[model samples]
Target: MRQGINPSKTDNRIQLESTHRVILSVYIPNLEEEYFKHAEKVFKLCLESVLYTSHDKTRISIIINGCCKEVEQLIYSYKEDYPLIDQVFYTKENLGKINAIYSIVKSNLEPLVTISDSDVLFLKDWQDETYAVFENFPEAGMVSPVPSSKGYLYSTGSTLYYGLFKGKIRFRDVQDPEGMDNFQKSVGSKLYDPIHLQKYLVISNPKNREAVIGCGHFVGTFRKEVFEKSPTKVCEFRVQGGSEEAYLDDPNDRSGFLRLATLGNFAYHMGNTPAPWMWDKLADLKSFEKSNLQTYSIPSAKPLSKLAVLVGKFLWVNLFYRFRRQFFGFLGMKEKY
Candidate 1:
């Protein structure tokens, strides 16, 4: 369903008139036998999350990077079916995540843009929280979710890491192992307990206004000005990682550019795992506010990573943590998500 827009009437005191609508760009690569085996399941989880949790005004744009006719048809079908999906663009060649995002973003840099991966599940009111942050703090360049998985890259910690300094930016900390059991049940996660260890979402503490400042991005939200100021090369060359998100929110200068992760996780990275946090969380999260939202789920989407799981287990055992850390781990060679 398409979201209704708020009236542009300005509050005289604050003089804030919000007309900005978020545009989400999802990159869909071909997932035949050569690609991910469970492509349909992964795609369904990603799409459903956006449909349910996003702001009503949000528009989704799919960037299909290859010339897969079936995939193109699939995206078109979605565009036609959903009123909220604004556009579907396909390229003849396969440009990976970095370049594909750069192509669209480089031109339409005004509206707030969400560059999302296809295998993600979003939580309740994810768009409301994100939009609130942007409206509240005009300086926030990027907003990410406090991830349960992909902890190394995007775990929203109370301690914000600067170049050398670590400042304690307080929020409700859910680092405890006890809460993990409940979260898994809420999302109907199928992965081992160990995977959930990294994939937990810290419900945003209402009192805190702090952000992680410069982050790792599975799903990254960026303000318009950040892109307008960046060079095309910086946007293009994220093959190894850092350059992609560097200039967006330089941690050392938080006053100028604020980088944030949603206080409570608004989304989950469905890396190979396919549990979306918004499916049924009102009861499990007593403190969580679920007003207009009900339950969301993709029962048809099952995990198709049995073979990948085996490979990951072998790698986890054969290589010591320290050995993996030394190599191109500075790059994402060691990363599981």
Candidate 2:
């Protein structure tokens, strides 16, 4: 039987009411390299997906920094369609992306905050499933979705995973094409239609949070304590790419935190200029539904048997850790080594 999700799941450590709050903030800086029109299309799909999947009390923030007048107007236009967007910040100058994010971190408005990029698509169950991690593990410092590709440590998509028994578990991180076909067969939609794909975003039992050392903030969420308890000096200088993620790295126990990524892809990145990840493959999402489509399945959530987990971990690693190179290509690295 499919189990319903607990929208208000929270950690038992903190004695709060049954309800929990999460804020999602997106920072959009005008890219000198990207054509604003093309970027606008990607951003709209991002907002459109957000509007479809978010729940009540989940606040959305859009921080606009030195964007073109057209870009500025596009963001505001979202306000009418997506009421979840309660906060919008307009920065006078382009202090760069990291600085723009730093300003939101300073606000201290919500206990959990997600630093989402402008070019992303949040699939069904994305919001609640995201909250499930923080609710289940209060110790979790950060969480990101498995990307279509370029997830680095958290990548899923014909990628490799090492199991627990003597570097044993070796399985494809996910099976997208087969899963998508299964979903379409169930939904009666044609192949490659993005709308039909949402129904199959089933949640899996994710337990390998410790395997990765850091997270990619392209669509990552973090607890406010990671920053409020950090007690680190804030610098005026800017650090590029994965800079915000550096907070969780905390090399010398400076900040005690753990970084994690979701089991399957909950959200996807439509790479922008300078870094175009899966854009050629995903730019077609705009042809999807104008409203939320509800015919989806929530997979049964259960932990695997200890012996099963062991077999998955030990048996597979022994057989395939060497051949992982051929299956994963150069971009996909073996976790066991």
Candidate 3:
């Protein structure tokens, strides 16, 4: 005779079962010297975030997109300091972002996966919150922190729409007038006040099953099964030659957002940027809020490098192009590094 299992007890056990696995794939190309500081900051955050949430460090996998001697050295040094980092994978040739991510699908990781840019810093609660979203809504393909209108302005796509006007809500009209203004003030700034009330327009109504299109990669998580089954190639950013721009060409154009939409997957953005004690701007916000508690902390990047960044940002909005060129050059794409 078989013993009957209590229904409530069974339910609790089911919930506690660790059926899902999460791999945090960070695309840090060793080639870009300018973003080294930013990369360091991102690494710090990733490490702490995992340490805070994960009871077993072996579950987390760190994928360094393009590898070089210097990049390897950095990873080695970090490993020496923090032993929790389980696996570090690197490629000899610099594969574009989409390609690098696709490479991980080949590895047969757990059912859940997360791809993040090196710029993202994580607090302890970040992973828990992200995982909660996945556990609660199994259909959700990805979730990201809602872009805060605080220090760094929130933007969408190549257009970079900032705000809306009362009379005319045209895209061109929405501009953050006061330079370097926080997102809070930027929302109120006459040029683009409307976005503040809308909260960056990054997420969809959780109550309603609407398809959320795009989100910044600062912090994003997803299910692994969705990626393994995805026929559409993770297209590389061609103009920029990164992952966001990459997509499937023939049958579908399902990039990150579209792919999730196709599979009835949803996403959410946390809306916390320049987080406390991480950057000068974020630190000021923490002080302003009168919150002394160190809820969480992550690494931070200095604004931009002195040389090409200025020329890229100021010269003619060629920051992307200039940076891409510099990155490829450094990666030995142009010549041997």
- Give the alpha-carbon lDDT of every model: 0.49, 0.48, 0.38
After superposing candidate 1, which stretches have Cα over 4 Å from the reference?
1-29, 147-172, 175-214, 234-243, 246-255, 273-337
Return whichever of 2 and 3 wins on TM-score: 2
Please report how far candidate 2 places residue 145 from its true position, in Å. 2.2
Candidate 2, residues 78-126, lDDT tens digits: the string is 7666667766788766666666676667665555667777777677666
Model 1 scores worst on lDDT over the 10 consecutive residues at 295-304
lDDT-wise, the better of 2 and 3 is 2
Cα error, residue 221 of model 1, in Å, equals 1.7
Q: Give the per-residue lDDT of model 1 (tens digit) for 229-286.
A: 4654634443436654354433212223345555455666555444444334422334
Error of 2 at 59 (Å): 0.4
Which parts of model 3 have CA positions greater than 4 angstroms off? 1-38, 53-58, 80-84, 147-193, 196-214, 232-276, 279-337
Residue 115 lDDT, candidate 2, scale 0-100: 70
| lDDT-based ranking | 1, 2, 3
Models sorted by TM-score, best on top:
1, 2, 3
Local error of candidate 2 at residue 153 (angstroms) = 6.4
